[model samples]
Target: MVVYAPAVLFFLAFCVGVLRDRRRFSNAVFLGLAAVFALAAWLVELIREDEQLGRSVVVGLLVLATLGIVVLAGFLVSNGVTMIRKEGRSPANLLSLLGGVALVGLLALLVAAWVLHTHTLLVVAGTAVALAGYVGFLFLCFISYAFLYGRLHIRRRADYVVVLGSGLVGGSSVPPLLASRLERARAVHARLSVRGRQPVLLTSGGQGPDEDLPEAHAMADYLVERGFPAELVEREDRSASTEENLRFSKSIMEKANPDYRCVIVTNNYHVFRAAMTSRQVGVRGHVVGSATASYFWPSAMIREFVAIFLAYRRTNLGICLALLLGGALIWWMR
Candidate 1:
């Protein structure tokens, strides 16, 4: 019971942070740490109550977890194959299969480290494993918090619905990915209308060298074809990236209403990162996610985490240097 106190405190802090600003990634990290500590506390209690029963429970849970990962890896590999067949052999489409193969390789590394009994290889493997575990923990936090955030309800009326754009297909056509964002923006628009408000639907993206027209224009045309009113639709066709999208869109919204609230729409795989971008640019709104292709999600998620890690590279790099120095000292001692 006493051990659970820290978990409770962390959860409370997380709740407070989220309530204050749901866009912050630190809040999610706290929530994840809280969950980890809470689970640990529960295991301790179980062990105290009955040692044998607790040990069995722990073993069963570990077995189930390991089996679950193996099954997931297999399914992802199969999905990756399907993605390649349907979407072509782009490296992105092959992500799931590569990830599955990587998992298998990791297991092999563990076996080899044990069997070879070589200190140098063991040290290298140990460092890799530790780094992987830490990254996995961070990803767990990100995904869990993103899932929670995506399900949040709109508590207030919005002045705008900003749909972030992806690349157009074949220079001029709207792809399914971009369509999903527009569809989500439409849904958000309907919700705002129901609340007796007509929020502007802003499509934000710039033209690429290969694109036939600005992405925002193509997105706007897509919405109109689907029967969305032209008058309520706005376009910010100069944003070449997510940060620029938010920055440019915020300027538009602010010009009309300085205190305007809005929702930023993107695919589910991008919701959290988009939220972080919104916060960085001082945008006022929560974010909502549309569905994404299942096969593309794992790879897209990895990319997002990498982007996030790099965004805070100074602190992360510092930590990595510290860990390396610590490992070197330990090795020297041995």
Candidate 2:
């Protein structure tokens, strides 16, 4: 019972963070830690109650964890194959394949280190394991928080519905991915309208070198073609990236109404990152997610995590370097 205090505190912090502002990434980290400590506390309690029962539980959990890893590796490999077969062999589609192969290779390294009984192999495997553990923890935090955030109901009415654009399919055509976001924005607008609130729907994007038109223009056109009111739709067509999208849209919303509240919309895979960005840019909004294709989600999610990892590269890189140094010291001692 005393051991559970840390878990209780972490959960309280998570609740407070979410209540104060739901967009912070730290909230996710807190929630993840809460779950981890809760599990640890349970394990301790089980061990205290009966040593044999505890041992059985521990062994069963380890077996399940191992099986989960194996299954995950297989799924990634299979999804990679499906991506290649269906979408062609672009670099983006190759992420899951590369990840799966890398996981298998890492497992192999651990086995070789054990079998060979070599200090050098052990050092290498140990370093890899430490780095992977750190990354896997952060990833767990991210995915769990993302899932939780996406499912939260937005009860407050919004003054605006902002749709973040994905690139067009051809030179000017609205792709299914971008269309899904527009459809979501339209639905939000419709819901607000039915509630007697005239919320503005803003499309945010910019022209790329190969694009025939700005993504915002294409998105707005798509909504118009589908019979959403042209008058309520506005365009912010200068943002080149997601940060720029939020920043530029914030400027427009600010001028029209300095205190405007809004809902930003993107795909489910992208919702958490967008929410974080919206907060960064000082937007008074919560984000909502549209649907994404199942085959495309794994690679897309990997890309999102990579972007986030790099965004906090200073801290993450510092941690990895420290782990490497620690591993080096152990090898030197041997």
Candidate 3:
């Protein structure tokens, strides 16, 4: 019973953080910690009550964990193949496949290190494992919190609905991917309108070298063609990236109403990152996601995670270096 105290505290902390601002990444860490400690407490209580049952549970968990890793690695690899086949052989499309190969290679290295019992192999495998563990923990937190965040309902009225653009299809047309976002924005707009609060829909995207016009213009056109009021559809056509999208949109939103509250609409895989970005750019908004194609999600999610990982590279890379140095010290001692 008492073993669960830490879990309870962490859970409370998670609740507090989420209530304050669900966009913060630290809230995800707290939630992950709560789940971990709860599991640990449960295992401890089980061991106290029945040693055999506890041991069996522990062994089962280990087997399940290993099997899960193998399955995930295989799935990522296969999905990568699917992505390449459907979306072309771009570097972005290779992320899931590369991630899977990396995982498999790490596992093989660990196995060989155990078999060879050599200092060099041990050091390499230990360092790789530690780095992977850190990354995997962050990935878990990201995925779990993203799932939680997307499902949360906003009860307040929004002054605007912002749709972040992916890109224009065929240089000037709205693709299904971008259309999904517009549809979602329309839904949000309709809901607000029903409540007698007419929120302006702000479409944010810029002209690419290959694009016929700015993505925001095409998005705004799409909305108008679908019966959205032309006057209500505003375009911010200078953002070439997500950060720029939010930053530029924030400027527009601030000029319209300094204390404005809004809702950002993007794809499901993008919602968390967009929310984080919105917070970063001082946007008074929460992000909601539209459905993305199933085939595109894995690689897209990997890409999103990579962006976030690099966004905090200083802390992440510092920890990786310390882990590597610690492993090298162990190898030298051996």
TM-score of each: 0.92, 0.97, 0.96
TM-score of 1: 0.92
lDDT of 2 by residue, 1-334 (tens): 8999999999999999999999898898899899999999999999999989998999999889768778888899999999999889999899988888878888889889999989999999999999988888888899999999999886467888999988987779999898899998888788778878899999999999889999999999999998988999999999999999999999999999998999999999999999999988899998999999999999888878888899899999999999999999999998
* Local distance difference test, each candidate: 0.87, 0.91, 0.92
Clashes of each: 0, 0, 0
Show where candidate 1 strays beyond 4 Å.
89-91
Higher lDDT: candidate 2 or 3? 3
Q: For residues 300-324, could you state the per-residue lDDT of candidate 1 as single tens digits?
A: 8877887898898888777777766
* Candidate 1, residue 293: how far the Cα is off, in Å: 2.0
Model 3 C-alpha lDDT per residue in residues 1-334, reported as the tens digit of each score: 8999999999999999998989998898899889999999999999999999999999999899889999999999999999999999999999999999998998899899999998899889888988999999899999999999999996578999999988987899999999999999998888888978888999999999999999999999999998999989899999999999999999999999998999999999999999998888888888999999998998999898999989999998899899989998988887
Model 3 lDDT, full chain set: 0.92
Candidate 3 similarity to native, TM-score: 0.96
Candidate 1 has an lDDT of 0.87
